[model samples]
Each structure stands twice: as C-alpha cells, then as structure tokens.
Target: MSDISPTGLGLRHSLSLTAGTPVLTLTGIRPAEGIRPGDRLVARSGAVAVLAAETSTLPQAEMVAIGASTLAHGQPDETLLVPADQPLLLRGARAELLYGQSAVVLPARRLLDGQLTRLLRREDVELVTLTFAAPAAIYAGELHPVTRPEPLALTV
Candidate 1:
C-alpha cells in the first residue's frame, strides 16, 4: 500500500519483515513506531539515522543537524535529553518539545557518518534509559499501551 503526505513526499514502503535482518529488536533505546511495522519512514536526502522512541503517533518526523557529533546511543523507550541547535538527523517521526527543555523526541535511524570515532565522542546526549524484556519475557496475544509515561501531579 502506498501512502502520500500532504507535503508530497512519497512514503517509502519496505516489507515489515525483510530477509536477513541485521537487527531484530532494536534495544538500548526506544524506537519510534515508524521504524517498526505498518508505517512510513523517511529521512533527508543524505542524513544519518538515529534510533529514537516515539513520543506521539503522528506521520511526520522533524530533525535538525547542529554539528557532526550529535547522535548518542540511547536505551530503547527512554528519553534522551539533548541541547538545542545540536545537529540532529531525525527520521520521519513526529515529536513534541517538552516544557523547560529544548530536546525533542522524533523518529530517527542509525548514524551514518564515516567519522564514527569523532561522532561518538561529540554526540553524547543524556539518555533517560530503559529496561527491555526478552522476547520470552513478553506475553503475546495481549494488548498493552505502547507509550506510557509516569502520571503527573496537578497542583490546584
């Protein structure tokens, strides 16, 4: 199935399960559902990919590349605190800017800069961290919320 966005960017489709998958379940950081199945993923003409957790269920991803080193390894489903103006290569995953912070949670792919050493050095975003359960630990045929944050308190 082919889906098109209002921006006219053709939604690229890939088999949910491809042959010889390099990474079966991307752990260490939460990945946006866009990187998952049943959705469209897009990146800039020549931008790197950084796996990120999904903050919302939108069909658009926005990112900014501030510098050569702006990607950091993150735990699956964890929020990464980053500085604004930092070069970011975001995949097609819509995100929301949290209050009191300039960091954003958008869909991202893997880092693709040849300067792995340097990039790894400079790209050190603070990761909130997450704990992933093994496939056997997860119960199938059950429904659960994909994203659920801690409840906030309201001060009346």
Candidate 2:
C-alpha cells in the first residue's frame, strides 16, 4: 500500500523477529478520553514525560516489539509505525507489530588468552534478559540500563 514505504532512514535490515519476543519499543501515555494509533499524545507518565509538541528525554533501551497474535485482548483500535529513536511513545492497537520485524546484532569479542585464560583466571560474565507475555504488560513497558557505555567506565 501507499502507506508502507522504505524512504525513512534508521535501522532497516532483513531478518525474522517473531512477535511477543522482547525487543525495545515505546509506550505512549493514554488520554482521559482515550486514544488510537496516529493520534498524537502528550505523555504524562512513564520514565519521563513530554509536553505535546515537545521532544522527550526518555532513554530508548528498554522498549521491545511484541508479536501480533499476543495482543488478543484490549487490542488498540489503530496501529502506527513508531520512529526508531524518537521519544514519543505510540500506543494504539498493534503498534508492536512494526517493531517485531527488527534485527538485533548481539555484541561479541575475542580475547588473546581466550578460553584457556578465562578458565585459568576463573572470570565470570553475565548477560541480562527479560520477557513479558501479556499484551497489557508489554504496553506498560520497562526500562533497563544499556550494556554498552559512552565513555567506557570500569567497575571493581
């Protein structure tokens, strides 16, 4: 359809991201009268709030796209595409579907000492992960600290 176009630039890669999988996504504050996709909203709650017509300061690390089949109850009447790096959270019906097709590349590194060094030193590493089943819970959303750092800080 005319509504779907590939002109907008952000992160567009070919990969299969299933619905309901935890991927970073946004959630817009609902209005008193209620709202739908494409309906502009003034965020009044969440990690941060933004006045209508203003930019937001909320970090986009915790947002994730959910599967379509998962949103059977309280389905939003409308669905709209959310911008990848914007603060305006879009909540309507099936907006998470737009994000479900995303392709995420996990970070990996090689060490000179490799497995032998890690075994000898007995060093440990951890990877954090989360999953939400309810559509409402997914819409409610959560925020987490990014694994990557800007300036590189050491922790002891």
Clashes per candidate (backbone, < 3 Å)? 17, 9
Q: Model 2, range 16-47, lDDT digits (tens) per residue? A: 11122122234444321232223332212222
Instruction: Write model 1 residue lDDT over 65-116, tens digit each, in one string.
Output: 2232233232222222222222232322211222233333321222223332
- The 0-to-1 C-alpha lDDT of every candidate, in the order given, reads 0.24, 0.23
lDDT of 2: 0.23
Model 1 CA deviation exceeding 4 Å by range: 7-9, 13-22, 25-156
In angstroms, what RMSD does candidate 1 have relative to the true structure? 17.7
Q: Any idea how many clashes model 2 has?
A: 9
Candidate 2 local lDDT, residue 128 = 22
Candidate 2 matches the true fold with a TM-score of 0.17
Off by over 4 Å in 2: 1-70, 85-156
Candidate 1 lDDT at 34 equals 25
